[model samples]
Target chain A: MRLVQGNEAVVLGALAGGCNFYAGYPITPATEIMEQMARVLPARGGVFIQMEDELAALGAVIGAAWGGMRAMTATSGPGFSLMQEHIGYAAMTQTPCVIVDSQRVGPSTGQPTMPAQGDVMQARWGSHGDRPAIVVTASSVKDAYQMTQLSFEWADTYRLPVIVLLDAVLSHMRENVELPPAPPPFSRTLSPDVDVEKPFGNHPFVPFAETTRTIVTGLAHDETGATRGTVGHASEKIIRDAFNRLNHDYAAITQYREYRLEDAAWAVVSYGITARAARAAVDILRGEGMRVGLLELISLWPFPEPTVQSLARQVQGILMPELNLGQLILPLRAAVEGICPVAGLGRADGELFTPEEIANAMTSHSTHAERRVSHHA
Target chain B: MPKMGEDLHQYLRQQMMPTVWCPGCGHGNIARAIATALEHLGTDLGQVAILGGIGCSGRTPFYFNTNAMHTTHGRVLAFATGLKLANPRLTVITAMGDGDALAIGAGHFIHAARRNIDLTVILYNNSIYGMTGGQQAPTTPFNFRSTTSPFGNIEPTFDTVDLALAAGATYVARTTTFDFAEMPEYILGAIRHPGFAVVEILSQCPTYFGRLNKLGDPPDMLEYERNHTIVADEESVISRDELLGNLPVGVFRQEIRPEYTHQYADLCQARGGAYRA
Candidate 1:
């Protein structure tokens, strides 16, 4: 067990998760992840490459993973934006890997050093099409480590890319996070049975066929991984089958942690650094005789919707505390079916949400919702 | 160098005799140089993989008797990088032409060199696009007429050696089919170079580039190369204008840098695998 910054935690978590190859181009907030990997990966018997740009960095990682190695890359908004195309390729091919995006302000190269949650939507939709991911967010250094470790597990288990969504605040800020005893849940790899799954196999095993466990690219591919989109075999079922297999077994990989929600009238759902501030506010509100609970989202994509829905049923309203203009609020609202009042509290001014700010939002919103619910009752 | 004999011909024939490349094309010369280099190294043929991108140069993989992949245009380096990292023991080589490497694949080429990946890139620079007809290429000399540039090209040529060197390629060299005797030496040296190595071969596209530019026949193109090119000096630095109408063919730069795969493996080992992470 040890204390570490969120940046160091990502590197350590990647190492523990069996990511032996890291290729990246240094960018703000994400530079430390590359720096640490460059310094330690070589000494530890892994390879760290500082590529010329984000495209090659992602390409190299994709190639390394193809060669049967667990690989990863780190970047900020600009770099992550460049990596979307390759990320789409990874998702379509079911290549098990991890990408850490320590987000910052950006439409095109916004503030480099400042923290922003602007990439929440981009992370979900940055790639060209509807490619799903197993995304995890971290509120603290320890959460960064734990969530990243979980991200690798989900990535390997589902055979797709997993994103560890961090922000500038968590990426650069120093913290004392106790390290795990031994990196839990060793990363998975292709089984020897995968040998039967060839790119041009005339007959492929049906189980792995639908999963695309072997073929990892965007080209229209058959079970053997050969590209064939002609009329006879131009079945959309192939795409649906591949994605369905991925979507079919997502629940086993989803994870989250709930805090003080047993008999609460209001719920605060937060992730990454904002969750820390929300928790502080929750404590202050509890002292003020308000039943406020904290629901820290460990996994963002393949979102823990079932839990959020059940919790929303118990609460009169839910407040999504975030660092940007509230990207995850819509998902939370849609999942709960408008049963509870959902409010998005965010800031894009590159400042952490102070506890007082969250307390005011939570306290004020809960009070307003209580009066409305009582009048309707 | 070992005498080019019956065994080399047998290796070539095994990849299917009537090769896809046009008759008298310089890609054959480039393929010969690569085979000679590999043969000189006495490497286990199975441990070497030649990855190729689409173009006249891409077909070199079909005639090379090794683990070869005919990948999409301008993507050879990306796939080759993967193959190298997978085993690191496998000698990975990539072959591509001007448009393949310079135009659409420019991003990949520059980035591959910058990483100093332990892969050898054999760029066959034939000035014009032969497979797609004589369109202008990145290496097409300024004021040279082509199918696309009927009134002579206006854009400056991208010096292959200069681009590689600037992009941090550990080994950069320029050779030509006109200097066939030296081609094997450059190829072998590049293969043995410890880091990212790029060998730019000034190849002859007698079919398209010749007809469009009125260079006449295959032998005529070779004669032009022999007449125009100068052997570059190691210590000298010259501008593009100085080399205008004259290709400088020689070893350009050779340096050493840590390979991407090595550092990647080191990270793996640190993470408790065979290599450090």
Candidate 2:
């Protein structure tokens, strides 16, 4: 175990995951990732480029991904917004890459040094069009390191950009993390063969192979990678298939942790740094003998629908503690609307939700803590 | 230069016939010259990737039977930079248009040249956004009438060759579709250059630029090119600096600069790593 910041852990983890190309533009809470990449990437026999802007950063990352390299970029809120264009492009082209957003407060560069989870919804739907999104949130330095590597695996396996969402609080926090002793989890980046001929049965996915002349475009394209102009007919189906390809394994792809939630009446649904407080808040509620629990969601997109719905049946109410103005609550409410009453405990004051604050919010917002579980059908 | 013996038409996607471009658009001539240039250089099509932006010129990649990427508007150079760095052996040919390169993607254009990365960039200077119905491009000459500029364009034009040279491109040249026989040579020279190489082709847009500006048919547009542009030769003293909105068709700059990817490879080697970017 060694002491490392969440941002430093992300750099170490991405390199371990066989990331060969890194293109990034500096932003606070994420610049360390770029600086470390620039320092060590060349020595490790990889490419590190500081692009003109966040738009070009993601663009170059997508291009390197097409070249069959495990490429990535790191940025904060403003940079993430700039990246939405190429994020949409990466989705349309079905190129695999990893993007780490060490999120800070923002409608637009809201508070550079402060922490806020305002980009939770943006990560899922920032880019225009109905594109596929795989977003995973890291709650600690360990989670940040582990998920950064897992992000690469998921990006390649799903053939889409995997966003590892981090907030300013977690990014700056230091912790003792035990990194893997081996070359790390993602060993596949070395082979650099996506095998589109057998797997995707498409040429557009492979950029360098000679046997299949690849053609990648952002427009709605037919199976031949030719532009179909309109988004209807065969090309529409192609786009649809590409967009929801990861949904088939939604349950598997979407992950969450149950913190003493096996037996509870009221629960808190939270993720990232807020989830840390929620976990502590759950322990506080249990001490008060309130029969409350915590459900820490890891994968924000491909949301754990079945798990959240199952929890709603067992619990009478759920309090969603978030750093934003209740972004994830919309999905949480939809999951448990008819079964139970759900409330949002939001804090976007560029600070984290304390344990006592979360506990107080849960109890005050709880709709009749004594309500029977029999209220559910 | 004894012409390369083998026929390069094998690299053309003959199966994908009926190009999307309208009739009399000079884009087709420039594309043919590119194919001929590839043939002249004996570049293996399999190892070549034709990357393009969103415009009439952007569609050039789909016609080539090589590895191609049709990217977003004005972002072809950004993609090409990454693609070339990822696979240093693969020759990346960037195809972009006037508005795509000089307007929306102008930042990437200068930066790619500033890096001096190895790329064969073909800028199709049509002076109009034909794909979007002939809006005025950055290269549109003064007093020109476009769909967007109904009366007359009062804005000055961009000298593409000068911009390229100023951006630190190792090889900068300009040609015209009217100079059809000699156009391939410029493209061939760009392909052979080891660093950032740019070839701006003054392609005519008869469909829009011709119709709106009363430049007549495609033949008349060719005549305009023959009358307006000066060909650079040993006797010529005019520099691209004094373009004054008129086209200058010739090689403008060629220098010995350290190519980005190759320098990176040397860095990796010095660091004792086997991989070369």
Candidate 3:
């Protein structure tokens, strides 16, 4: 086990995951990822390019992915916003690539060095159009390494852009992490022969052979990657299939950890750095004989709705403590769907929530639940 | 039941016929020139990739039979750069318009030239944003009227050849849709060059630029362009101002410089790992 920063772990994770091309522009809190890539990727026979801006960074990553390389780019909030257009393009073209957005406080260039989970919703809905998003969050340095590797695997497996959302604190914080043995590089399965007339098959899910001459466009296209302007239902069918593929595999896609929920009456739902405090709060509340548990989310998008539904049945109330003002609570409340009461304890002033603050919110939620039950009775 | 030049079918996507270009638009001529250049060079269709931006010129990739990527507005060069670096064997080319290249995509154009990566850029200079109804573009001549400049354009125009040369492109050339005889030769030369090569084709947006400037019809515009151009030679002593209105149409720069991807390969070789292919 060696101590390393979360950004450094991301670099090691990307290399171990077989990332061969990294195109990025340096941004606060995410610059280390780019710097490490520049220092090491070339020596390892990979390509590391500092692009002109975030738009070009993601653009190049999509291009590299089409060139049959496992490519990635790292940036902060402002940069992530610049990449939304190409992110939509990557989704439409079904190019597998990883984008690591190390979160900083911002609507636009807000505290670059400070941590904020304001981009949680943006990660899912930043790009225009209704596209499937696979976003995973890491709360600790070890999780950063593991999740970064898993992000590449998921991107390659699903043929979509997977976001590894890291906040400023988790990105800069250092912790001891045991680096796992490098897994065999995961590559897209391609056919050996080429059908020149139909390079891409009838299904967008079906992987096209690199040997085949194919056209990949952002326009509404049929299975063969031909633009079908106001054509039949081919475009709609392909987009539906893309979303259905992920939705059907919810068991594999949804990832979360439940703590001390054997017979809990209330729970604290959180992710990223806030989960760290929520876990501590859960343990403290348990010591005080309060039935409070923690549901820590690792997979933020395609949100574990089923899991939340089940938890809502078991718990009377859920308190969501986030760094932003009630971003995660929207989905959490929707998942609960009036089955249970959900409250948010948010802080967007760039300070992380303390264990005591989360515990206090849980206590107040329990009191409010009791008062409401009595009044209803 | 095929046409006379059925062999050209190998390079085209026949299904996406009835191109959206206006009847007199010069983009068709530029596209034909590119097709003829590829045919002349005999490049492997499977190993070639055409990337295009959002404009009339951007749609050129959709007609090609090779691997094509119709990308975002003004960002095809960034994408092409990555593709070329990742697979140096692929012949990558980008098709963009004046507004796409000089206005929004100017940063990428300059940076790509500075890097000297091996790729070809075909800038279709229509002098107006034809895709968006002919707004004044960076290449629109001074005192010309566009939708945005109804009275007259106050800003000076950009000479793409000079821009490419200043950005350190190893090969820079200028041609026009009117110069149909020489367009393919210039495109072929640009494609054959090792480093970043740009061939700026002064195309006409007859529906927009022609109408706004009262330049008669497509034929009239072509005739005017032909008469205004001077064939640039090594000993040419024409001043920049003179060349602006009466354009100099020929290769302006060709130099031997270290290419980005090739140098990267050499670095990988020196480092002694499994990166070399």
Give a tens-digit lDDT track for model 2, residues B100-186. 999999999999999999999999998999999989988888888998889889998888887988899999988889988767888
Q: What are the lDDT figures for the candidates, one per model?
A: 0.76, 0.84, 0.86
Best by DockQ: 2
- Interface RMSD (Cα, Å) for model 3: 1.8
Q: Which tens-of-lDDT digit does each residue in A288-360 have in candidate 1?
A: 9989899988778777788899999899899988878878997898898767898889888788898889989
In model 3, the runs with Cα more than 4 Å from the true position are A183-189, A193-210, B1-7, B239-244
Q: Residue A29 of candidate 3: its Cα lDDT?
A: 88
Docking class of 1: incorrect
Number of the predicted model whose TM-score against the real structure is largest: 3
**Better candidate by TM-score, 1 or 3:** 3
- Residue pairs with backbone atoms closer than 3 Å in model 3 (clashes): none
Q: For residues B163-222, what per-residue lDDT tens digits would candidate 3 score against the true structure?
A: 999999999999899988778887888888999999998888899999999999999999
- Residue A336, model 2: Cα distance from true site in angstroms: 0.9
lDDT of 2 by residue, A86-183 (tens): 99898877788999998888888699999888898899999998877899998989889888988887887777899999998888889998887536
Q: Model 1: per-residue lDDT, tens digit, B1-277?
A: 5455345663452524567677888888878877778778778665666767778888776676565555556766876676576558777788889898988788789888987878898999999888888899988888898889999999998887888889999988887888887787888888899889999888888888888888988899999888888776486677877777777878888877887767666556656656521
